[model samples]
Structures are given as C-alpha cells and as structure tokens.
Target: MTDTGWTTERMPDMTEKTVVVTGANSGLGYEVTRALARKGATVVMACRRTNHAKTVKGRILTEVPDATLDVRELDLADRESIRSFAENFEADYDNLHVLCNNAGVMAIPRRETEDGYEMQFGVNHLGHFALTGLLFDRLLETPGETRVVTQSSGVHERGDINFEDLHGEQEYDKWDAYAQSKLANVLFAYELDRRLDEAGIDNVLSLACHPGYASTNLQRRGPEQEGSRIRLWMMRLANAVFAQSAERGALPMLYAATGEDVMGGEYVGPGGLMNMRGLPEIQPSSDRSYDEQMADRLWEISSDLTGVTYDFAQAKAADDD
Candidate 1:
C-alpha cells in the first residue's frame, strides 16, 4: 500500500456530481453507490432488476437519509435494453460526471446473451463498450472533468483473445471466457484513454480497477449454476478464509473514480500481499493487456459487433469550435 494508505475517506466532495453505477443492487456496485451517495453525489443505480435495485436504494437511503438515488433498469445482455437505458438517462439528466462499468459475471456455464454473444464476454466487455459509446457524447459535453471507470480482475493475466474462435463454440472453458472478458475491460479502458488523448480531449478520464479477492455473490454463481455442492462449499470456504469484504474491495474503484491524483489509463487494485486484499493503489496489469495491436483489433471488432462506433472526432471538433 502507499504510505498514505488511500481509502474512500480521502474521496473529494461529490456534491452536485451525477454518477451512474451499473449493477448497483449488490456487491461492490452497491458499496460504491452508497459511498458516492454519502459523499453527496446523485447516483443513478443502473440495475437489471428495478425492484431489487429499489430495495437496495432504500437500504442506502436508510443509511444516508439525504442520499439522492435513481434506480433505472439496465440489462447489459440485451442491446435494446442498453439503448433504452441511455435514452431514458438522457431524458432525465443533463450531465453525467462518472460512469462506473462495474457489474460483471464470473465463471458460469456456457451460455449466450440476447445477441448470441458468449454471456461472459458479452456482458462484461461488449455491453460496457456499447454503453460507453452510446453515452460518451454527454461525457464530452459535460462541464468540468468526467470519468469512465471499468472493473477488471487479476485472472485477466491468463486471458488470450481467440480471434478465430471468439465464442468458444468448438471448445468451451468457463474460466477462460471470464478471463478474456476481464482482460477486455482493461484493454478497453487503456484504449479509450489513448483515443481521448489522440483526439485532444482532456476533460474525460478512463481507468480500470480490480477488487482483489472480495467476498461477493459472484464467486458462488458459477458453482450454484453448475449444481456442484462440492465446488460451492469450496468457494464458500475460500471466501471465509481469504476474501475481503465487498466494502473493502470497492475502495480501489472508488479511488479510481474520485481520487485527486488518479490518472487515465492507470489500473488500480489492492496493495496487500499478492495484491489479494488491502488498500487501493496503482498497479501494473499483465503484458498482454498493454498490447496496442490487440487493443486496436478488439476495439474494431467490438464496434462492429455492437454497432456503436465512437465519434471522438466530433467531440474534438466541438472543442475546436
């Protein structure tokens, strides 16, 4: 950890800021929403289930009675849902200060999303990719600094983008799919920063962060989906023994989103033993994640697949004017 041991307490005042957190009903997202709200930010809880998110919002309101929260339905698996959410958000809010692409699934059984893409890759990477593209205009036009923070994982070190068999139709491995998706998150974050710089746009920052080994419902989903009692027990034991609480795990993301010294393209995570649990700090990602060639290829393919190409030139032109 850094000498100062950065924590959420160090976050700047967020009064008047509007933040959107995907999957805000549970785990790290929930913790992030609560913390941002406590700091006086208006948080839009972009969740898949409106009812559950409203309940979570109530929980937050109980803790921070004056917190401002807006629960909106967002299903990352479906492109239509994403578009609708963006449209509704544009109608409801004039400015967006932060977009936290934090919701994700872990190692689960092979499945396809509404658009037929692999579920893990679709929701974790492409979904966020499309969402960011759709709402990037607001980020550019909004006054003052803005941020796009993506959540990745340490397992991303083992990921390889299989261009030939992107969906793993021939050979499927759940962990491999999850790793690929997480890696894509980091790549997208870095590539976005590069594009912003290239376009001479400095008002928006893009970053990626990971919650070391936070104990959350994500780890249990795969085992439960597989109906393996032994695996579920093992996961539970690991969480009990080694994992940190979701609140602690969320610090890295919160720091990335609100830290005064945070920079675009940095990857933040725990600074404890083996980067498993501790205070948030800037860290290096895997060598593969820094490959410009791979990132460019992924960016092109993602835009083609999602049909949501970024219009950075337009933002630059507006700034020039």
Candidate 2:
C-alpha cells in the first residue's frame, strides 16, 4: 500500500497485538496509544507516573470503551526504573508486538539523569537504547512481525554528535543538546535495523520517525523548568503560529509502527511543507544520521554506559529452541 497520505485510519488491524508506548499519558504518545488501542491492540501505557497514566487510560477507555489498557511505571531518567519496568513487563506479557520509544525530554537546561548522563540525551536516547536492549530478546522471540519505533525530531538536521563532550559537561546549549539526542535516535534506529539484518532476523524491525512541528507539552517544559516566563511565552507563540496538533504530529510514528509497506531503517516524517506538518511519509534524515562509524561508536558507548548489551545470538538461539 502506498504511504502517500497515510494516517491512523490506514493502520492495519492490531488484534491480539500488544504495544508498549512510553510517555503514553500525553502528546504524541497519547495519540499513538489511543489509536492503537482503538484498533484492537492491548496497549501498555508506560509513563513515569503510574497515577497519571491510569488517569489517561481512563480517558482513552471513555472514548473507546473496548480499548484494553495497562498502566505501568517507566521512568526513563533512571536506570533502575527502566530495569524494573522491563522485568515486570517480561513476567506479565508473553508477546510484545510494538515498542514505541516515544517518551523524551526536550530543550531543558543542563541536568543529569540518575546515572549522571545529560538529561536530554539520557532520557531521549540512552534510556530508550537501554530499554530496547533489555527487551530485545522478547521482541525476537515474539511470533510474527514486531517493531521498535523510535521517535526523533526535525531539528536533528542541526545536530552534530560531540564525542569529545557527549554529555555537555564542557559546554551546554539546550537546543543543541536536544538536537544531538534526536540525531542519536535516528542513528540508533538505523543501526539496529542493520544489525538485525546482518543477524538474519526478519521478525523484528527497527524504524525511526519524527513528529514534524507539533504543539505539545514538550515545548513548555524547558521554560517551565527554568521559570522563564518570556521564553515560555515565545514558545507558546511559536506553537500557536507554526505547530500542528499532537494528534496530527503522531501520524508518522503510528504509520511507522503499523504501516504494512514501511521498511526497517526508513525514517518516517511529515510529507508537507518543509516537512513541518502533514501526512506521514518515508523521508530522509540528516546526512550525519547515516554515518555507520558514528552509529557503531554510539552503540558501543551506550552499551557500556547503560550496561545493557543486546545479545542477538542469544535471542536467535532462544527462538530456534
């Protein structure tokens, strides 16, 4: 099927599928969860706050009375939390059809995660990297096709991974850090697809997508944290003038997660003016995002920092058994 004007309406039937959506309580993540649940998928709403997720789940159920929803705690800023969530999820669910790495921190001031990594990169890239590795075996062992859809951003075009100071310890620019983390998202997704291909693994696909310019709570976060009223006002103005709805922005990720014609390693985004807002379509990411050497380096460093190594061989062996 052509992805010319793909939207959530074009999504395939998701009966019997189980999806995990991080940050499912709001914004693009919320839209994705609601859409998938409406399509007959049992959605695990992975949020840092369980109470809030439960509230969101209730809201979704009100709209789609038959939607199956599960609220689970997943704090991407903390390694311990990530590990706990993965362990709990593995014990409870036998199948994981789609993992939407949709949770992230945007242009926040320099901060550190529980593991002392930069806040934006930690939560946005490294955290998801670790989670995917932790759940790799489950994805591989699951029957039929499974997907790991990572959320990136359009600002990745301006990113340049600074290996010398990846954490921004030397210097920090909020927007630059955010861009770096986003570029890392695309790199990780493409690298994962290549690795899966090399291992002869066809059941699991890794794809990356961006939400163009969506008006979400993400924009208000940085200024809110810093108590910058003027900055917040500017962001609000920008959103009002240039951004699309979170529901519209979420189309790319939903398409990446469910589109039958989508291929692994493809970067899905808006097909509209300047790629800011429109229907979902396969698009090209930044040239730097395709650097094999950089991706490999990031993967290796991420495994070391997070201590979550992906054992594709073990997963393959388990599948064979």
Best by lDDT: 1
Candidate 2 lDDT over 1-321, as tens digits, reads: 234778777899998999999999999999999999989999999999889889888999999999999999999999999999999999999999999999999999899999999999999999999999999878987889999999999999999899999999999999999999999999999999999888778899999999999999999999999999999999999999999999999999999999999999999998887899989889889999999999999999999999999887767777667
The positional error of residue 262 in candidate 1, measured at the CA in angstroms, is 0.8
Question: What overall lDDT, based on C-alpha atoms, would model 2 receive against the true structure?
Answer: 0.94
lDDT of 2 at 45: 91
lDDT of 2 at 29: 92
Q: For candidate 2, what is the TM-score?
A: 0.98
Clash count, one per candidate? 0, 0
Q: Residue 169 of candidate 2: its Cα lDDT?
A: 98
- Candidate 1 similarity to native, TM-score: 0.99
lDDT of 1 by residue, 193-298 (tens): 9999999999999999999999999999999999999999999999999999999999999999999999999999999979989999999999999999999999
